[model samples]
Target chain A: MMTAIDQSEHHAALENARREFRDQLIDADLLVPSGIAGLYGRGAVFEDIIDGIDRVVQRAGSAAHGSGIRRLRFPPVFPRDSFEKTDYIASFPNLTGAISTFEGDNKKHRALLGDRDAGLGWDHHLTPAGTMLVSAACHPSYSGLTGTLAQDGTTMDIYGYCFRHEPAIDPARMQAFRMHEFVRVGTPEQAQQHRDSWVPRGLQVLEDLGLSAAPVAANDPFFGRVGKMLAANQLEESLKTELVVRLYDDLDEGTAVVSCNCHRDHFGVTFDIKTEDGEPAHSACVGFGMERIALAMLRTHGLDVARWPARVVAVLEG
Target chain B: MMTAIDQSEHHAALENARREFRDQLIDADLLVPSGIAGLYGRGAVFEDIIDGIDRVVQRAGSAAHGSGIRRLRFPPVFPRDSFEKTDYIASFPNLTGAISTFEGDNKKHRALLGDRDAGLGWDHHLTPAGTMLVSAACHPSYSGLTGTLAQDGTTMDIYGYCFRHEPAIDPARMQAFRMHEFVRVGTPEQAQQHRDSWVPRGLQVLEDLGLSAAPVAANDPFFGRVGKMLAANQLEESLKTELVVRLYDDLDEGTAVVSCNCHRDHFGVTFDIKTEDGEPAHSACVGFGMERIALAMLRTHGLDVARWPARVVAVLEG
Candidate 1:
């Protein structure tokens, strides 16, 4: 078993490596610093690579589903009540994004200004807008699809500007990230089939992009004692799988670039959605962390896109 | 010399027209409502049109600036200090969006659950993240480009999912909408020239897309008495212009689909960006409200994409 000192040392080393990679990216103008941790701007080169990765994934999704897949776009902030139904705040309250806006009159505004001048925070004046920033690409999709579905169900290509409150220096762990999710909502068999098929297909997508990747049984970092039980059950049932890549050679396991999950009928029951057979629809989604996958490509191939493999370049640059 | 009753009637009529247009969009399934005012999810058709409009704007930007323009992408949020430098809150306090997240540990989480269970909001448990949701496309671009520039100046294509606190039923005014900005930063001459040229060029771009638009003198709705002075000064200097379109035929004036502003030395000095001459840069940008323009298109044409004129359709469909 690892001792306390040994664990601290390991964490230090891991952080150093992450910092080193971040410095390299900043030096090459691949990333722009925003002064805040986990919040960095994407330079032209970095955005280009992300664009390439997006195209690659879009092509893959289209190839598999054809016109069956439809793109769903949502603004980052969603209705607060919709978020409440998901109970995401219960497990990940620390990472939830709630919008606070100035809702006061002129008198309150003057007091806010006074607080600002006095060097005190005026955050209290900014009341909650009754909306929460989207934490996942598929979260907002459910509220829009609340009624009934067709016989075979629906396939959606949902993209969201996701937010998480974990501020860190790791380039892979951005506070605000983009998640591209291929979600299937329908019968239990269909949901399972979608997740099962994506496990290999997702690994292949990254492999084809010239990254060494593998599928690993995984569970989300659920919070608290009850969360521990949920995670264990989730792992035992193989409800979650992650396609991970070795971002750093020194690391034992890989970082998850893609997460494939079968949520059973949790969302369907909560959102009041039913399948063609009149039962609660089972939902499954394969979410691609667009930036993380691109970061892996940068680490494996090189930061320079022109120097990447010709085959990979063609797929991304298209 | 309209009576108070007349004014109220005008507002009622305008709201009725907005509701009518919204109903049409809903029936067509082009716009997906999130059950909240101003927040929406774009259906496949709506997304396709947005894609088309983006391509059209991109083509216009590229055709004018060539490789001289670079695309800058920022997350939906930025540092609170960075926002303060712009002094935006002083003028538009009610429209600012600040992020709040749960910062408490397990003990606090338990208390939070208690409050939530008691039907009282746990907003008090959440603290400010020191990052505000982006309100403009070009807001975050300044902090990243805080340094000397080339002799000729720099041009950038920036896009942002912007937010404003004002929630409304008018389809043209989305609380969370996109702004596609073609920005130029340099000498005073360069900034003015950029804005002046775009006054006509921007109109043409929209007109080509078959939007019945025209440029009119405009001013931001600044807060209170001081804001009135700012607005007057801005108007006197001709610092702001808007490309407005008639959302409803009964309205006296059109709604702004695009805003062209010359923030001369305002952002440059604020962000500490310098031009080739060692003096502070002057900034100008033509911001196209993507959804508003698309809405204008839908109003001008029809809700059905297939029924739109071929010339107009080609501009957006590409």
Candidate 2:
């Protein structure tokens, strides 16, 4: 008994079936358009199915965090005072972003080329290039995992290029994407047993890459009116979940492509970290959403990955 | 005889040997800073030598572009009117970047939380997020190679995540980076024989990736005083070259990890792209600079890629 694809008529028929599956993946060239609305350009067989779903999500996140999950990466900009100490602009200040520039000189680059030749807008000669943008690929690995955290707690394997200004037409609501995550941290019973074992190991790695998924109980578009009682206390304590799939067909609300979360101790008290007994560490994470599972494997096997499913292209070319 | 690492005393002894090789790559944990100044973070042995110099640069760009180039990736923001039709903000407006957001509502998000509680800065409630950051990994594949071309004039390969605000201390001057290129557009004698056959096949692919490169004739930091006469007519029409390398030790000037250039028809008269007998097509590219060849393979193999060089780690793990 669940379905609220956002206040009614299946949100404009799930946004006209995600704008006709993003115009048939930009007419089969596998999405390339960059004329704004969510910025893109992937091609090369949609980046060889996002590099075979990024090497089958790094061998299913190193077989669920064993190779001492460390990897890092980052670079979609960060550090504007470690993104304002992750108060995340008070809960997604309309999906934040910042990186502005033109830090002038030469008489302010000749009045920024005379306000780009009198259009009166050289973006007020830009500014705050102390960086920001990355809105979460595990928010720059919780500022390099602040401090302490050993008693069975520690893992990262992050990634990056994330942003959200929510411009949509649902090519998986991109406004710059890619995520990858994994995270973890520690204690609170190993962060709820590593998010209850990645909510059924992320629906068995998105149903071993061929689709059919589930999970649900999610929440976190949280912002405004005390982020609606902190998104109903993060869905009455379930602490976010996601996974979901239904890439469109009969869309009774799915599109999450992996999440998990858990965050109790909210990034170990905003990264003072702790744990191995000194308490406060519990973080979690999961993530994925790499081009929303390569647009849910080009909306459930089609935009030619040489005809998708043969044991899902042998576990994404094994 | 070229030592202008900028100004001279060999520019503060090549920035004190690139600040002691960025403090021995942030003391061997292979750089993960991000407290701004050319942001960092990239561990797992600095991303496995940047994924083994990105698979020996896609097998030296598919053994020099045979598999019909065409990789495309782009997503470090672009399309702000195709970035002002590549005039490149009148030549690198102090290294560009744009993304801004907080598109108000909820009473401008409580006046952006009362300007972050009167520190008075909600970045003027952001705005122009039509995107813009990537400064070139072949600037969004010349707006998808605009129009005509096919008298053997097309290539592309491409790649991305690039930005350049030049806040340095020479960790290869990264202000957000990564590039890969290959490009070529056609007929101005195939863009001057593809930048004169990649200036000696890019110094023999950086001496088969063990570094120690050469090839100079550069020029481009263009901007004022009529961009110093277009950087002295691009070094008297050599139209850019680069390659360079000497990562440090007694640095007599190097570091310009592969460039090449040769935009003979200035991107076919700014993307009107044409060639198969239509004129206007001549372009070129080359690029590379992926994390300045992973900081010259950790300044010539030291950051223990398991004690590097076994034929340059078997051409980067083959």
Candidate 3:
């Protein structure tokens, strides 16, 4: 298990290592070539990497639109009133960012200071979708699904970038990460069945990829006054557990590559998700910590990526 | 081009198709397993897919950390003040939300309102990460990277789930999507070289993964008054060209799966991303639209993931 002490040391060491590596790459001319569309040296290689990602996404058996999983993508921003209805601010005040309008003196100073090369001033930053974040990939899926979905039982798998405001530097715990989440909605039996099904399979995926993994109980990093209770309940019921393993980084504590959680109707009820039979659906999600997995593979293999096993190369090539 | 009219129609059809596919899977028993942890069903098969992803990540590259890329997971929340500095609210007012302090109407009502459910005259629903959705993955990445990164130029391929408030719903143009962004920071030469190098490599990867892709010019979805000028400048300078191809949902408009952007020094100047060399480092990114590519793969092969080509499977299985 990773403790605060372990995380702190890991963060410092990782930051140092990353800075060094970046310096080396720059010195060696191993970077994006000019003329590549977006910023750095973009070339067919980047496209190839993307294509490789596509193939993996397909093989994951969670094909989009089909693959027996319901897929719904909703607006990233939600109504401010929507969140207020849920009491999010009170529970996690420090972690939240609210978007507010500036119609006073502050707003005027911003206008006058325009194009000072300071970019858009603060006063102009008024938008209704303030503080809202798709903390997890499944939130939007639940919200969108509830909007017009039939009251019948449904299961959905939504994948997207889940963001957080952590100030850490551990590669395993990124501020921004790719989350491949499979969300389900239905009766308790249905939700539990969904979570139960993916556990062993998720393990197998790790094994097949030539990686070692273990399923362990996990908890969200819920901070502040409510965190203790949240943690206690999670441990008590074993509601949250993640698969942990060692990756390439030199961190003392291993990383969590996969988190298979059973939200247990937490979201279904919140979003008014109901089955065709009008029963409030219970929901569960199996989230793949994509970067964690990637780093794990790197550690399992050699540092020289070119020397990676042919089999692994073949998978991306295919 | 993904036009307004065509995009609307295409999205509607895609949604319908998505629903139909989900229904079919349930009827087939192949999908009844639901979650990844479910019993031996499609979820179990996802294990196999994960193996493929592991292989690819290992073969593609290696960082010093270990096998997986060293990830710096940060808190998923940002301060409200930070967003305001980014000018997000004014540019997209309708898409923003705000967290607020609610002063009750009266002593009795205020006291009652303290209990969210009681105040609302109903049970309070579950609230996930509120309005702090990431319009772009780079926003958070930049926030995290700029603060602690060594003055020396550094580069990283950060992956995350990016959300957008798209009123439209084309399968290719999702509201929530995964962006595999390879960002680099360094001198102009280093940045340009990095971008340039990926172009051919990107093409190769796509071909190796068995997808048809081509480079084409693009423009951002800038809306409103200044949006036109921004879009026009981007188009004229070819600032937003992407490598795109036709997806199965619609064979007419070419869908963008990979976008290679050259941010030049925009973010560098804005965030004051100074390189170890003491000069403002230029930056660029190669972004992969993971879902679009997956959708393309489904259309290219067949809806039935099992029937994918042997070669394609081989690469993924690697």
Candidate 4:
């Protein structure tokens, strides 16, 4: 489970490994070729990664539909009403990033506003949207798709920057990273077909780039008692698995390159996403961890980036 | 200086060109090829562009001084005190992005915390850290350099994701973009010399990739009565000029592929950025818009990213 604070040495070790892995990516040219030599913030990298991830998904959708895909991008911040209906905080209480603002006198605002940088203190900041941090790209996509679910199943490949407070860091798991989830809403068959099609195509793309990627059963990082229950449900129903690769011989922090989740009727019932027959539509999605992929490619490939094979470079460039 | 918002049909056309340019880049195999397409915010493309631009500048710095250049990467969000001394809000009053919070009543908090999605509104968020949205990457770098100038002359290359309130839809002029500013601090001569070196190098980069670029004097987009005076002053002093290129023959928005600015002790006086000789240091920076370059590359090369010249592909892959 993700925690707000920690002193666990085991968890600390995992975080160190994650940090080392991040450095390795920079060293490998998959990350900043310049190296991670200075201070950087989670917010900054999160923002950038989110942007890049979104771009790839958008281009992919455009390519698949040639302008037929309706684009709907939501604000990073959303109202609480949306999440309440979805039961996000309740389902994963500990996992939700909930924030509230401080109310102060007008004098406080003036003091802050008068001096470009005054001591307004952390508490003076405004209340943040409840559970604003998107845990998954699909959350926002679902919000955007609430009343727009097509009976024939609409396909949306979206990008979003998501955040989580994990005590440990794995090259496969990031505190913040870009998540590219391709969501499909329709009859169970249609959704499954969409989900399954990606595996082969994704593998083919990897193969073309000279990567040896394999699909595997996996469970997402859920939280507390409810999270465990959610995972159990997913496992019993065979709902999710992520594609993994070992960036290093140490399995302690091997990376997760792709996450494929076949959400059965969970979302259908939640948002009333139904099919032509008015049955709750089944939804499934394929998520690609762009940073992880780049890290994997670099770990598998070479650091100088100049050394990437011509063919592989061609594929990536394309 | 950044403006809150502005929109024109011309802006929309530029946005279209930007989209087309991104598409072309995907086709050229120059990038993994994302547009604002993916599930996340499309801002990743903007971030990637900024990073790419920084890489070019970093490479240039390395070439100039093999390992002597101290590469420093700073946090995007800094302590509010830093901005106060710099007078950023006053100078770029309209452009700064401030983070504020709203504090809710106990009843409201209980109601919000109880609901899954319905949570605190923005009105109750906390007072923002005295931060203006960063209009340019140089602002933070300059602020850091204050009170620590190398009298003899010091050249430092820094990169950061910058934000601005540019309501214009021109892809080239985005609300946020990555800026790679190769900054030089020293005597007037040293600052000017640093700016001069990039002229040939930047052009060579374009030529090597088979693109034509031109250099032109430029003016900052300032607003209000005082802004007009500032703009006039800048013109009189010849402070800003951008290396531009026509992305499309039909589009009026040419890419500002590169920009070189000579701040003649303006920052030195403000932040007390001094030199080793015990005098204030003048500073100058050469900036490259990473996204615009990719756009330029798309225009110069074909969009079938796979077919981009092997040399360029090698650089990107590296």
Candidate 5:
């Protein structure tokens, strides 16, 4: 049996891996530490690389014809009620970020200002702002499709900044990050086909950008003891797959830069989404973590974009 | 004298204006409210408009020669210490959003999860995550430039999503919005010239986009009675100018879509930034509020982008 000690050891190994990658990024001047554990300031070159990768990923998505894909953009912070309906709080309570503000009267505000001026913590005065930072790009997309779906189904391309509370030294895992997701709501077979087709396409997109990547079965980072069992069940059912790339030449393992997941009626049931035939619509999404892909490119091809391969340059520029 | 009664009346009028704009946006399906005041999900058409405006603004920025402008992008959140150094807490304490998480042990975690599952507020367990959501795009840019500047000066183009706590039904006043800012650091005169030149260029950019924009003196939305005096002083000094456009056919007043600001020596003093000549480096910036510009375009030239003037379409497309 995997004991608590085993979990501790596993966590320590992950921390070391994160530190190694962080050191290399810092050396390259690609990342400037924000004095926060999981947050960092990316320089101009890094920003350019991210922009190039995003463009290519967007182009790759354009090949999905006949699906009538609608593009949507959302703010990182979401309505608290909308978030609660997704059941993310019950599943991953620790990773959620709630928006709050100081809701005190004038006299209390004066004291709050004084505390800030005196370098005393002023967070105690913060009241809930009736919103929560988004944990996934597809949450709002799924919520938006609540009532019913057409017989032919619907597709959406969404991009947004997402937040999580898992603060770490890993350059790969950010507290706040960007996610580009293509979501489809349809029949079970249709949803499965949508994700499966994207698996090879996702890998090819990275390959075109000059990064070596592969798809492997994966599981969500569920929390605690019961979460361990849930994760095992997910892996057993093969519900998730990741497109991973080696972050460093010396590292034996690869980082998951893109994820393809089939939620299979879970969201439809939760959001009360039904097909025109009166059946629960199954959902699937292919998500590319933009920053991770950029990091992977930097790691595989080196930090200098000018020295990058010709094909990569052509794909990004063209 | 502006009494409490006057403040209440002013707020009521602002609320009415916000509702009018909100109703118009809803009718156009350009905005889907997130059930949170000042937050909305943007559709593809709205996204396209925003993208067009951003591209044109970037091209307009390219006209600055010899400035050697560097482009930078930052994540939405910044280090808490770096955020505190900006002294936003001392001024606008209520408008800041600090990132926090539920940092509790497994036993406490179970209780936290239970509370969330039971529909009890889970935010009480969230501890500070050591970072805060950004209030301005230029804050990180200025923080990154702390230390010394060359005698020739430094120029930077920054774009990022910024957050504020003000919540209303106003379609224009988003809690989370994108800001495109061009910043300069040099001697006072050089910084002043950078801002002054941008005023006409900003107006022209809007004019080319078929929106009649005029640069009018403006002030920041400072807080409280002391802030009112500060705003008056800023307006008197001509430190800020805004490109305004009419939001409604019924209203004569126009909204500020863009702002040109001269922050002479303020950031230098705050961040200890110095020039090669050992004098405090003055700073100035021209910021284009991306959503506001898109909204202005939608309001001024109907919702149909195809029907826009030939010159406007050419500039956006070309």
Candidate 6:
């Protein structure tokens, strides 16, 4: 158990790290704060880095020995019913954003307008729109496969804007972010093997891009006191592995840019996804937080793209 | 003025046009609906077309003769204060979504979870988070230039995921979409000239992609009865021009896939942006609705990208 002083020291250290990234990003003009914590406008240089990282990751996937992957793209929001079916709110209720709207008649709208003009809030007039911002890229992918899977299983590459309502001063933890994920659904053994192999493959991809990365055991960020126990169970089961890299020269403090997870049958049970053999299909996914990885690259290398390592430049520019 | 019957007829015709596109997209498996109108998960083919459109659009900008353009990227949400400052609520109150969260404590969260478990609504716990989904890509771009401009002025290429709350079954009008925009801040004449040139350039880009496009006078979708007058005034002043393309075989019913607008110091005044000469900087922007353009391409050329025109395919695949 951590003491109060230890906890405070840890908090300060984390703050210092966040400040270092925020200050560098601001100085390089790579980020423009919107006066909102954990949300900022990224500049061209930052976007270019993201684009480069995307290319490298995609290339890595294509080079892998597998059946061609089906690529799917989704908007930031998902159906509220689908979200509920996933039982996500039960685990992480505080981390989701529901998309709501003002569904009032003209008179009520006039009232809303009045509120806006009177410097009062207009949100009171807003009603739930039966949808919510996506909490993960794979949510829709799994929801899309609600029924039986193929006998040989399936592989999909999915990307989308994901949202989590964890607002903080830390640039690494964005409220709204992009996620690039590769998901596979098959027998339990096949799924586990895929995730185990991806742990190293993810690291290799980062290394090929001139980033120093190491895979470490990790767990999902569950919420509440009960969630602490769940996290502990997850770590004990070795359900998640992350590829970590130092954002700065201090190797002791590393950030997880890529994560690989094996969900033994969690999604299959929830979404009624079954293999052709009539059993619940196991699933696994490797997700790369694009913005965090790009930020890590910027933090590791200098802000100048030209000054980046030649191999890294070649991989990105290629 | 349109009669009540004429207005109803117009609405029906628009709905039919939308249905035509949605049906075609569904048949092609390019889209998977998320149980909501105007919201869908895009498949690989759809994503590829979007990618192709982005490349064509970017190339068009780079090939343009001008001073180098600064590129900026912003996330979907913006500071509520900045949004309020823009006074968007005065005109389009019905068409925006705010990013809010559940700020309740752990006990409150437990109660929320109980409500979720009971199948009662849980959204009641959410409160406004002081930020809103961006209504336009240029909102942040203009907000970023809130101070003074250089003598020679500035040109920026901004892109972002934009949102509107107008839910419809029409695939042509998405609730959440991407907008690729070019914004210029300078003297009145300079801004106007830039917008005027982009009108033709936008059409040319579409033509090169084997799409049939025409420029026409247009107006923003202002709300309420008062909004009609505002829209008429806007069109009368020739403030907006759009590149229209037929979403289906019916050429009479065309959609605006790209738009060019001259704000004439509207943003400058609102954001307190001034030129080096001590005058409010006039601003103009040309925005391309990426999904709409890609959909237009698929509609015009057919769903099979491999069979597209050689020139168009080369430009996209290159």
Instruction: State which candidate has the highest DockQ.
Output: 1
> Model 2 RMSD to the real structure?
24.1
- Model 1, span A1-318: residue lDDT tens: 989999899888888999999999989888888888988888888888888899888988998899978788999888998998788878888889898888777788899999998989989888888788899988988987788997778999988799998998789999999999999999999999999999988988898899888899999887777678989999999999999999978654778999999999999998999997789999999999998998999999998888898999987876
Candidate 5 — which residues are off by over 4 angstroms? A1-29, A249-252, B1-21, B65-67, B249-252
Which ranges in model 4 have alpha carbons more than 4 Å from their true place?
A: A1-110, A113-152, A159-176, A200-216, A223-225, A248-253, A263-282, A302-318, B1-112, B115-318
Q: What are the chain A TM-scores for all the models, listed individually?
A: 0.97, 0.37, 0.74, 0.75, 0.90, 0.94
Considering the two chains of model 2, state its CAPRI-style docking category: acceptable
Per-candidate Cα lDDT values, in order, are 0.89, 0.81, 0.54, 0.57, 0.83, 0.84
Candidate that would win on TM-score: 1
TM-score each candidate: 0.97, 0.34, 0.53, 0.57, 0.92, 0.94
Interface RMSD of 3: 12.9
Model 6 has a DockQ score of 0.67
Ranking 1 against 3 by TM-score, winner:
1
TM-score between candidate 4 and the true structure:
0.57
Error of 5 at A192 (Å): 2.1
Model 2: interface root-mean-square deviation in Å: 17.7
Candidate 5 reaches a DockQ of: 0.64
Candidate 5, residues A1-318, lDDT tens digits: the string is: 769998788777777877977887867768877666787777778877877888888888888743478888998887778887777765676887877887676678888787876878878888887777889998876767778787788888899999888888878889888999999898898899988989998999998988889899999987777778978998998999999997744344678999999998888888889988889899999999999998888777777778988888788776
Tens digit of lDDT per residue, candidate 2, span B1-318? 765754577678778888888888878878877766778888887777777777877787888887887777888877777777777888878888887887776778888788887877778777877778888878777877788877687887877788887788888888888888888888888778888898887777778778888788989898778789988999999989898777776666768988998978886887788887778888888888878888888778777778777998788777
Please list the residue runs of candidate 6 whose C-alpha ends up more than 4 Å from where it truly belongs after superposition.
Answer: A1-10, A65-67, A248-252, B1-17, B65-67, B249-252
| Predictions: Cα RMSD each | 1.7, 24.1, 11.0, 9.4, 3.4, 2.5
lDDT of 5 by residue, B1-318 (tens): 769998788777767876977877866768877766898889888888888888899988887643477777788888887777777765676787877777666777888878876868878888887778888888887776777887688888889999998887778889989999999898999899989999999998898888888789999877667778878999999999999987754344678889999988988888889998888889999999999999888777777777877777777775
lDDT (tens digit, per residue) of candidate 2 on A87-144 = 8888888788887788777788888888888876678787877778888888777777
Candidate 6, residue B297: Cα displacement in angstroms equals: 1.6
lDDT of 3: 0.54
lDDT of 4 by residue, A67-163 (tens): 5443333323333445554565444443444333323344543444554245334433333323244567676655444544554668765654454
